[model samples]
Target: MRMAAGTEDRERGADLAEAAPIIRANGLSVYYGTKQVLSDVTLDFPSNKVTAIIGPSGCGKSTLLRCFNRMNDLIPNFNMTGQILFDGVDLYGPGVDSTEIRYQVGMVFQRPNPFPKSIFDNVAFGPKINGYEGKLDELVEQSLRRAALWEEVKDRLKSSALALSGGQQQRLCIARALAVHPRVILMDEPCSALDPFATLAIEELMRELSEDYSIIIVTHNMQQAARASDYTAFLMGNEERIGELIEFGETRQITTNPEDERTEAYITGRFG
Candidate 1:
C-alpha cells in the first residue's frame, strides 16, 4: 500500500508524534521597544535531538534561540512574554536564576571568538567560575576531546588560543561551553564562518553531541538543516515584517515535503 507521490504533507507530518517533546513553548512573543518581532509561536524540542530553525533573514529563528538561554536579556530594550519550559520548568519563572539557566543551556555564536589566553584557559574559564572542584587538567582535556579539537591541539595546550586556525578557535569555544556541562546547546549559524571542511566537521560534531545533549540551531542553510537536524522549525522575517513561526516538523518531511507553502518555497529555491 504505497502512498501517492504528491499527497498532503500535513497528513504525513501528523504521524510523527511518537516521542515526547522536552522543551515546549506556548504563546511566545517578543518585542523590541515599540516593535513587535515575533507573534504567538509554540513548538516542542525533543530531548537529545538536533532541532534546526531555518528561515529567511530576520526570521525570529535567532530571536527564539536567544530565549532558550535568556541571551535576549543582554540586549537593551529586549522584552518578551512567553513560557519557555525546560523539562517542565518555566525558564522565565520568578524564581528561575538566569545564571543557572545559562549554565544549563550553553550557546555558540557565528564567529569564532576566543580569549587572548592559552587554549587551556579558554576551556577552563567556565568551570572555574562555576566552582568546579574536580581535577582541572582532566576536565580541560575531556572538554577539548568532546569538541573534537583535542587531537589537533593536544600538543599546544599551553599555546595562545589565537594561534589556532579559525576552525580550531570555534571548537575551542564549543569546548568552553561544554566545560560548563550544559544539557542543551544553542548554536547561531555556527558554520557560517567556517570553510566547507570545517562546516562538515561541525555538522558531524553536532550529530555526535546529540547523543547526550539537546541542540537547537538557527541556520539559513536549508541543506544543513535537512542533513544534520532531526526536527525542523521554519520562521518568517520579523516585524517590520513581523517574524513568526511558519511551520515545524520532522527534518526529512520538512525538507522533502513541508506543510506550509512558504516552507516549501524556501526549501525548493522558490524564495528564502
Candidate 2:
C-alpha cells in the first residue's frame, strides 16, 4: 500500500523482523465527546522494532498509543473512526474482544503502577486471572528475568512491590506485562519518572526487549527516541488541539533528516 505523500515507506532495516507491519492504522481519528483529539492519522508499527511516537504535549501521542490495545475505550465519551489492524485483523471489527486484544498487546504506563501485592504476585497476576495452568513459579521467575529484574528481587519474591525503588517498580510492571506473553508491548513514557541512570536502564531494556517483541512507545524525550527507537512518528497539535501526523519514518532519518519542515523544527528545538 502506498503511504500518503509525507509519510515514509517501511524501510528495510536490521532491527525489523519483517517488511510487513504488525500494526497498521488507516485514517485513524479519535475524539472525546465533542472535542477531537487526533485527526485522520495513519501509520504502521513494524514487527520486532521499537517505534517511537514523539510530539508536543496534547498532541494525541498517548491517545493513538491507547487505540492500539483499545485502552482508550475505558474513558467515558471516547470514540474513534478508523481501522486498526493487527496482523491483518481489524481490532475494532465485530466480535473482537478488547480483553483478548489487551492480552496479546500489553501496555506499560508512564508511572510504575505495581499492585500493592508481593513482587511474585504482581508478576503472576495476569496469568492467574487468565487461568494459566502452567507452573506459576516458573512463569514469575521467567518474566522478572526478561524484564531484567529477577536478580534484584529474586530472593524477595514475597516482599511487597511497593517496597521496591521507583525504577525497580517500573521494571516489575514490564515483567508483569511480559508475564502474559504478549506479542506487542505499548509503552507510554516508560522512563518519564525515572532519573537519568534509571532512564538509561529502561532504554537499554527496551532495546533488548525489541529483539523479541514489537514495541510502540510514546515519549517526549527527543534524545531517548533517537537513541532507542528503530522508527519514529511525529505528531503535532493545531490551535484547535487536534493532533496530526506530520512525519513518519526510520528513526535516523526522522531525527537527522526529517522531510517535513515542522518535524525538523521540532527536532531541532525551534519549537515543540
Candidate 3:
C-alpha cells in the first residue's frame, strides 16, 4: 500500500531512532550522456545526525547530494540508474513525483541565490507553492528564528533580498529552506563562498538545526567538516577511486585516529 508523506516521514523517523537509515542508496550510478561521472556507489544516511561528505574536486560529492533530491534532473542529458530510498520508498519508482521528493528533501547550494524579490517573499515562496494555508507570517518568523536570521533581518522583511550582505543573504537562503520544513536537508558546499564569520554562523546554524532536521553536507574543508559534523564520509574521486569510503564513524575518530591511510593523509594535510 502506498503511504502518505506525513506517515512515511514518521515511520522513517521511528526506524532511524531505532538505528536504521532514513535514506539508503545502493549501486548508485550516474551518467551525463554516457560520460559516467559517478560509478557504482552505495551509502546510507541515518537521521538527525550531521553527516558530512568530504572529497576532492570532481569526486562526485555534489553529484551524490543532487541524487537525494533528484536535483540532477535539472542538468541536461543527466541520467541515473539506482535506488535512493526515503522512508522505505524508492524515489526513483516509476510513478513517484520528483517535485514531491524536492519538497521533502530541500537543498542549499554553494552560492546563496536569493530571489530579487523581498525577503518575506523569498521565505514564503516554497510554502505558497505547496499550498501552505496556515498563518504564513508566523511560519516565516518561526523559520527565520530557527535559522538564526530573524534577529538580523526581522526589521527588513520588506526589503529586496539583494540588498542584504552576502552573509545575510546566505542566512536568508537557509531561512527559506527551513521554512519549507523538509525532513532531510541537502547542503552542497554551503560555505564555500562565505567569509569566515559567515561560515562560522552557518556552521552554528547547522549544528542547531540537526536537533530537528537531518542534515547532509558536502564540504571540501576538512576542519569545517570535523568541527560541524557528528559523522563524516571521506570520498576520493578517481577512476580507481570508486569513491573510496575512508571512514564512516564519529567525527572525532574520522578526524583523529582514522583507520584508513588515505583518510590520515587527507586530514594530516598529505593531499586533498
Question: How close is each model in CA RMSD to the real structure?
Answer: 4.1, 1.9, 6.0
Which candidate gets the maximum TM-score versus the true structure? 2
Candidate 3 residue runs with Cα over 4 Å from true position: 1-18, 240-244
Model 1 residue 85 lDDT score: 90
With a 3 Å backbone cut-off (N, CA, C), the pairs that clash in candidate 3 are none
Quantify all predictions' global Cα lDDT against the true fold. Answer: 0.86, 0.91, 0.82
Clashing residue pairs in candidate 1 are 238-242, 238-243, 239-242, 239-243
Q: Considering lDDT, where higher is better, how would the candidates rank from best to worst?
A: 2, 1, 3
lDDT of 3: 0.82
- Report the Cα lDDT for residue 169, model 3: 86
Tell me the lDDT of model 1 at 230: 93
Candidate 1 per-residue lDDT over residues 4-108, each given as its tens digit: 123324564355444456677777889888888888777778888999998888777888999999888999899887788988899999989999999999999
lDDT of 2 at 160: 100
Task: Supply every candidate's count of residue pairs whose N, Cα or C atoms clash at under 3 angstroms.
Answer: 4, 0, 0
